[model samples]
Target: MNVYAQILIDEAKTRGITVKIIDEEANLYRLCYGNNSVLCRESLTEKTCAMAMTICDDKSLTHRILYKSGLRVPRQAIYINMTQAIDLMQTWNSLVIKPASGEQGRGITVDVREKEELQQAIKSASKYSEHILLEEFVHGRDLRIIVIDHKFVAAIERKPAFIIGDGASTIRQLVKKKNKALIQTTGGESQIPINTETERVIHHRNFSWEDVLPHEQELQVCKTANYHTGGTIIDVTDEVSYTLRTAAEKASHVLNIPVVGLDFLVPDFSGDDYVIIEANERPGLANHEPQPTAERFIDFLFPETKK
Candidate 1:
């Protein structure tokens, strides 16, 4: 079962709600409280309309819709031609290329500073999507704000996967050790791929797999801050500023989505400046530990179970 489904199941159990796994492989489950019953597949549920999910599923459409509503979004476009991408890069100086519709940071390339790297990024993104997106690289903290029932529930700062040097272990060794720790903590669900993407990220940082990092130096190994891609999440719910909270809540309202995880790039949570990158209709409710995300979701789905 996906961790998200298990989280809801476990939370339901604590509330004396009946939980039945309808399809383990699909991570589908049913939750019951007296006469009320609700069904969910992972974090998705009936609260999300098909149209909202469809809009969120398409990144290009999401941007257009949100932008038209006057919400801040990174300058992006559905790919038309290689020349268009190059022109955008030249004007913006940095670019982000990724599959127009994907999750968990799949087929995403960040910090494309040159033309040759842009070519490779497009090729990588094309592997996953025929329609690639070229976005102006926005600089800021990567913040994920979770909105539930048109209200802000939690916020987190997701940092790219990194390792601190011990002065002895090579980058390869550090990565191996980090992956093992990630598996242990996440129950083998998350791992950093030891593939060409990893190699490219390190190479761009002027390091090799065999290079021994200086003692206590930090090196970010992955460009994508996604759990499945070895990134770590820090709960920042209490630290969220009013500006960030309102932006997230308003964005959710604009999309008419009751539950969503909106990804944004901001200089800081206290600032008004932020660019909405993507919205996940079925965001992982369990990611913000000790924040009662799963419990709130249950409350929203089965109001009678509320404490």
Candidate 2:
């Protein structure tokens, strides 16, 4: 089962809500508190409108909708052909190529600087989705802000996966050690994969898997700061600027979504500048520990269950 669903189920039980496993294999369940009952699949519940989910699931459409609403968004276009891809390449200088619709950064390629890189990125994205998105690669850390019941509940600043040098271990050894810890903690959902993208990131920094990094040095190994992509997150609910909170709320309002995790790329959380990247219908409530994410989600699902 996804750790996300497990967290919600545990929270529901703790709140005195009757938790029923409708489909354990699917991570589907029913939470009943008194006369009210809600069906949940992972952190996603019936409260999310299909239309809102549709818009968010499509990256190009999400960007268009938010951009039309006068919200800051990265320059984006569909990858129709090599011609279009190269035109965007020359225009943006740095680009992020990914499937038009997907999650967990499965087919995302970032920091495409030139023609050859762009070609490979398009191929990578094409494997997942026929309609690929070519987005301007905004330089910033990922900031995930959760808005539930039309109110900001939690914010997390995510840094791409990295391994700190311990002097003796090679990059591969460090990665194995990291993966071991992640599997033990994250139910195997957040371990870093040894893939070409990982290789590209390491090589970009002039580092190799065989290289023994010096002690105390931190090396970023992934371009995407998605938790599923092995990124680490720190709760920043108190640190998120009021401006950002408002922007996130405004986005959910524009989408008319009751619950969402809005992804923002920002140079800094304390600053005002940022580009809204994507909206996740099912944000990982478990990741926001001690912040009442699961509690608030349950409250929204069955307000009568509030205690």
Candidate 3:
């Protein structure tokens, strides 16, 4: 478990909530309540336990159920073999390859255009799980919508927040300085490593990391807006439009899951249209800070149960 995960558990306990570390992998499993131990354990039957466990462990099934419920998700294909992956990408030259069962953007590759890169991405992503998802690359920003008990709780817009060079410092130095601050804010998850690919991207623009610096800002860096890749997260729950709310709520209803975090890619969620990228059962509640998603989660779990 990550630090944030542990913080969530601790926060729940502080609210007079009792949480047991069950061997089960369900993200948020409630094994009954009240002062009766035997009764609580007996209350959750095999079928109910299976259902709760099933939803949290699988992401492909989550999207399938949401799609049937009328949510606009990205065009994607689930592939098990290398041949199937190549065939799926044939239709779309550019696509995202990721593990169907992973979260927190682990083992996810975006803009895989060449066959070699595709194969590499597949091999890398496959390490996380047997099933892989090949999704059409949607040109838009990443939007995260948090839902609790059939209601929208919080929303955030994650944008890659990178600094450009002004022809002064080395890329390594700039990256180090940026990471120093990012680690303090994001608990060390947002620090982007200076790699050859990143340097190439800078070089492709006819610039070098040495030409840019802490003093002079000359060259532009970064093409994508992923916060995990040293981007910025903007709180936009108040700015979310009715369309986004409807899409998110409908997605939750379609999945038949009480707690969910829906991701969307769009020019603007306050606008008329957008694509419902995917739905997550074990959505990271720690991403939305200051708002305290853990508190909302505790409220959702023990709401009146504690009283």
Q: Global lDDT of each model?
A: 0.89, 0.89, 0.67
Question: What are the C-alpha RMSDs, in order, of all predicted structures?
Answer: 1.4, 1.4, 5.2
lDDT of 1 at 162: 90
Give me the displacement of residue 161 in model 3, in angstroms: 4.8
With a 3 Å backbone cut-off (N, CA, C), the pairs that clash in candidate 1 are: none
Looking at model 1, which ten-residue stretch has the lowest summed lDDT? 188-197
Q: lDDT tens digits, residues 1-307, model 3?
A: 3544555666656755566655333433333346522111211223224464476467677666656767777788887677777777777767888788866566677777777777877886788999888888888877988887778888998775467554556776777788899899877767664754356447666767665454555443443445566767788888889988878877766666666777888887688678876666656667787676777665665675432
TM-score to native of every candidate shown: 0.96, 0.96, 0.75
Query: lDDT tens digits, residues 167-187, model 1?
Result: 999999999999999999998
Error of 2 at 135 (Å): 0.4
Q: For residues 63-171, what per-residue lDDT tens digits would candidate 2 score against the true structure?
A: 9999999999999988888898888888888999999989998999999987877888888888898899999989987899999998999999888899999999999
Clashes of each: 0, 0, 13
Error at 255, model 1, angstroms: 1.6
